[model samples]
Target: MDTALQTKPCRFGDKNTSDIVICLKNREGIPKRFYSHSSVLINKSKYFANRLSHPGSNNCIDIYCSEVNYDHHVNLLRLLDLPTDSILDSFDSVKSAVGILQLAVFFQCEEIACCCIQYLEAVPWEDKEEELILKAVSKLGPKAMPILARIQPVDLAATKDVFISAVRIATSIAGPCPPFGNELKTSAQEQVEFMLGEDEDAPLVTADEEVKSVLRMGLSQIYSSFEKELSSLLLEPDLVSERAEEKILHSLCDLEWMCNILGKMDLMKDFVSNWAESSSNVLGVVENNKLDSFMWGLKIKLIEITAKVLEAVGYGNVILPTPIRLTLLKTWLPYIRKMKPLLDSKGSQETGFPYKMSEDLCQSIEGAMVTLVLALPSNDQADILADWMGAEQVRYPDLSEAFEVWCFRTKSAKRRLVEGLDGAGNATVSL
Candidate 1:
């Protein structure tokens, strides 16, 4: 072994310089080691030797180390006085790059981790690289969030199978081995929450101009897919109705996912707002039947998702476009108007109404109305609601209790919506 390799174990560690030296010497078929100090030695020795060594020399080191061995890599980088960014640039594969990022995070090397994450963001999400990508993300854990954010514009629909595969892989990465093992399940949940939240745990990496360009392009592609899907569903109401409720549910679920992604970008707000408008238009076309039920369900989802977007925008300090308010009110007005008869119709003996039918109908309508009202920009809508309340109270004086119940319901809804919208409004105003 060379004198540099033979030096006292202090630099590497006290216990086993021989094993370290042996690992470095043979450099063949090393099955992924995670020794903290070994990463330093391997990185340092390679750097000095690489600088002085011949360009075509076959004397290069090949060490197997987990991505989590980044702390050691950082120490090595420091010892050899190498720019961490330059060291990251040496990685020729996503796996290697991710491994270095994992180490950078593990060793508290923020700048290097940021750089590696930026690099990962530049590469497209390929089907063939799913496993490698998952492994790298798993090792980096929460620190990988920034990279995940950067890849938001990738064509998930084109890579739907791969994307689903990645989700499964991410679940596995966050696992407890036995399906829903406690540790893994908890980790996975935390990861989902972190990625979904505006206040993410990971720091945002400074992306290059090309990465930014690709992200914008990718996001536009995603929006196109969304537009295409929405258009298909709208044009073929029969097709939507023909599909099983579960299938429709699946599409809605995917929309929810898209909403989350759009929520992050700040660009998708208009798309989502437009979706709400289009959803309202379809509600009119839908006649009373199973199709109506599906449309109602979809409308409910839109309402919920719109609220979430508003909340997110408020947090991001992004001022919502004015049209959102008008679009939201227009979308919801028809549903509110439709609820009136449903609330008034009394059960009869010939064509029996279901038990609690009136009450349940009233509640559903009230809930939907409240959600709609809250989503509005709260200018003079209180008078509109008050007028509706007074008219209902007089029309159903015999059912004064129901009227009071409706009023209470409206009040509760108003409070909740106000609180949510107010918070969001404050955020927007501040921003």
Candidate 2:
């Protein structure tokens, strides 16, 4: 056979061609033996070099390994005898590379260890494998930096720069989504969420002041574009154009996406405030226009956004000036009430409405509306409840809680006034 075609290229375990006996001492089984050259062992491994350098000549060196590590050690021993170019071909997976790296580190074999590091640095790792690599490489000295580079903390300025760029793309105020724009924007949105995720691990990036500032700027840009779109629609004739609806709907969708990101960062107050200021105008445009039945989806989206805003305000997550708060409630409550039955009627048709209102969302809106109405001053509460009582669809908002409270307070009003006067008299005498 030609030398190139010989199967035993390394001639590693062939006793006929070997000069030294290498012993593999396993924890439980009989020690295994491998045939090797002293020159090869000394040249390939520093550990073997130091061990075989005793004052008296010895033809044997023993390597100890646990049962779990026996295969790795055997493979590594075979690798030591492999041609330098063929070394990487032996260990294929991340687990094998990591195992060999641990042994290479112990054997003080720089060549094999360097190859392992290169392989790990270039390959993608699964989640658990990443953890394993981190743990294994963490114990190694500065030589392992290549493997850690992917997980290391990036410079703060660079991180912020990338985030701001993504925000600009995601919240771009330009007209309807460009070619592949939705996909690109969706990707950007996902990255933003991932960076700020708190589900499994801590957030990759902290939403510090700088990050918040970028987000707020993006939010403002989108809202400004949205308001302008709404204002233009108000001035236009009641004729419904697909182009116009697309423009308005696109902006609303962007705002909805922003709501989710801001909610995660606890920055809902900015959104709630902006929505409060814009609520009257938003509802005004909708009421003025005669939208086609297909436009019912727009109303559902508005309710979804309004539901989030009401939840924030009603639960006091976002506090606002009393007038703004009252305006917000007044603007959205009637719109929601008006749209509910309309949407239900449309949904009941044979064709069926594509956008069905979420029952949970309706419940959330009603609950928030009740909490919000009750929190208002007595006069405001009376105005809201009186309006609710006269509405055709009083059955849904079910403001019985606010109604009952208002009734009790009104009934005891005279008695409370008498007690207040009596308390004032007693305080004056005591003084």
Candidate 3:
């Protein structure tokens, strides 16, 4: 037994008796040097073995490498410091593994090279790190791939571009049909899609079943997350955290964006309808809601989603059954009254209240409901207006004020319409 080896770890490469000096450099032409022993480098790398064969009778050699990443090269030296098979004995992080792979291939260290490739293969690459690993592998090319035969850097870049284009098309402000639809009909976008080789030409109907399944699952998860979020928000006494509210809204918007891309307008409508139905179902609890602050804040958020969905789908597209219709309108009626002076005068200024929806969202819901009503028979419209006013016997001064604003404006408009019809009738009789 070697008593010296048993008592203390052997410092083969870093010891004072090291026979070679290795200098490495980065892309910026800065160099990093390391102490090396000929035996270790020779046995581990055939390239090093051939290159470092003869230095001088003084038994010293210098090896400089300009092709390696400085950090990667340093890591490679750390791996070489240990027995070759033990290079992967400890897994630090995926990042370090990838870097080690790059260095192993560069130095022609076959044993550690095998371990690096295996480590990458066995583990998952994080989404954020996917492109980084791909780029590293691309730079290594055939040298890094012990398992695969070849890879195309251009193909990788093209695939990445396609992914980015898909995400952009998915998330951009959608047209009526939304997502990557009808927008491709425009020559400029068509040309752009064509240049990028994006398959805008392919009909969505032909989307692979696997793809559709994944999309459906994604939408389900989003809705589940939204439901959980509502509960979380409800638990908070003061849903006054604007940032938190904005984050929740943005996440819902992201899901809507996906729906737009999938041409799932029905899906979008169904969510709002279901939410409204769900709201109605939970009315007892809501009325019994002890935490008025959370209840009021939640009502405002629910109204925001409902209003946006209706506004976005256009009034004619959605059938707002009387209960659901009144539910939405009543939600905003107080705010409407509060903003009566501004809304009646059609002023640009906004109104605010503690338990109120944002002015813009309140206006959107009000406008959506108003447009639906205007398209109805005048009698039906009036009855709807009556219900708005008569929903409760209490002093709904806000509701009264809101109705007065609408009644005066709509009555004169209707009067002018009646006069025109009467005038046309008289003219027809003469004819």
Candidate 4:
């Protein structure tokens, strides 16, 4: 560890009062020399004891360090003289403690290492500091297990339990949410999203069949509540109950949130199926009612959800029977086409709460509708394209792609049929 250096004199103990000079050397510039007591060094650090045990004429120890770790090495040497309880007090933050812990581990100074660990384990860390702590402690092995315990992977059952609890709180929509309940639900919902999210690592919850089943159960309850609200609203379409309207809005919001979760888990098939099956009834409730300004938000929310369902079906992400697919389009397409101009008109007005549609959303809805139309049987495509061609407001959905495809297919149908008939007639002579 010995290296020749242009030394700067610093003393942990008084000059000439100590027999040993500890030289801390960095790769560049002048190395620092700390005047210290042999008694304190040998008793505190095993690394020092082993080095000092071998007799030499000049009692000096050289320790080489990187520029980044030079200050930590100096602080650790100073901390060696402090009492065990007071040693932890020197650590002002997790960053400082982590820097010291690395050298403490290398220097075989268990006391300082223990103090660093203690200080770190007791204090809170910023996100980056936590990553630094993990990197530092992971190199020190089992000796730093106390620090790692807090972040270590827990029992699978325990993790699933916590995830399930969060899901329950997030999706708890029975009667009415209390004033503070929304905040709690929001927090839970955000955490549930985090657990299920994937960025640098895999999602926290494995989302096996059991987890998916739990999610499905929660979604079923939400859908049930939403259906009940819609059914009740339909019973008296003319009568406007603010309370009932609010409940219906909240339920739709819940369904919208569920779409995100279910989509991530690839469990959207059931949700999309349910939405598709109920599209007619859903449209009926909206169509029969006279929509006031207050109802525009509700209508917009329904359309937003329908857009996601449309995208899923459009991309063939969620496969459905042809009839259901046809029904879904038939049920919602007219309403969507009608609502666009109304929403735009309302949005342009100087209202307190304007109902605006974003360009991206409009494009997405248009693209999805086009894809959905193209996915249908040729006759169904022809029917949709015919309707789209004749409609007064055909600019929104713009089913030209489907129309062109139908036209090309329709034009070639006769030639393909005649070719098939000629082949059949030619084969008849041999038979």
Report the lDDT tens digits of candidate 4 across residue range 1-431: 11221143223655755678888888974668888867778878999988888876268888898889888988998887677778876788777889999888888899899888888888888888888898888877787888888888888889899888878878883433687687878887899888888799757778788888789888988889898888887565444667757878998998999999999988989899999988888888777745444566678899899999999998899999999999899888888889998888876675664566678889888899888888889889888888877999888877787778778888799789999999988885543
lDDT of 3 by residue, 350-397 (tens): 354454445676567666666655554555657767766665432322
Rank all candidate structures by their lDDT, best first, as comma-separated numbers: 4, 2, 3, 1
RMSD of each: 18.0, 5.0, 13.1, 5.8
Quality of model 2 by C-alpha lDDT: 0.82
Cα error of candidate 4 at position 65, Å = 6.5
TM for candidate 1 is 0.34
lDDT of 1 by residue, 130-218 (tens): 56666667666676787667545545344443333333333333223575454553454345435446563442322345433443444
lDDT tens per residue, model 2, 70-188: 88888788888887788877768999899989998889888888888888998889998988898778878798998888899888778878877787778873433678777888788
Q: List the residue pairs that clash in candidate 3.
A: none
**Top model number, TM-score:** 4
| Per-prediction TM-score to the true structure, in the order listed | 0.34, 0.81, 0.48, 0.82
Worst 10 residues of 2 by lDDT: 1-10
- Candidate 4 residue 183 Cα shift, in angstroms, is 2.4
Tally clashing residue pairs in candidate 2: 0
Model 2 residue runs over 4 Å out of place are 1-16, 21-34, 50-71, 83-93, 155-157, 173-180, 199-209, 228-247, 264-266, 350-354, 421-431
Better of 2 and 4 by TM-score: 4
Off by over 4 Å in 1: 1-201, 204-248, 266-268, 271-273, 276-279, 285-290, 293-299, 310-318, 321-323, 333-383, 390-431
TM-score-sorted candidate list, best first: 4, 2, 3, 1
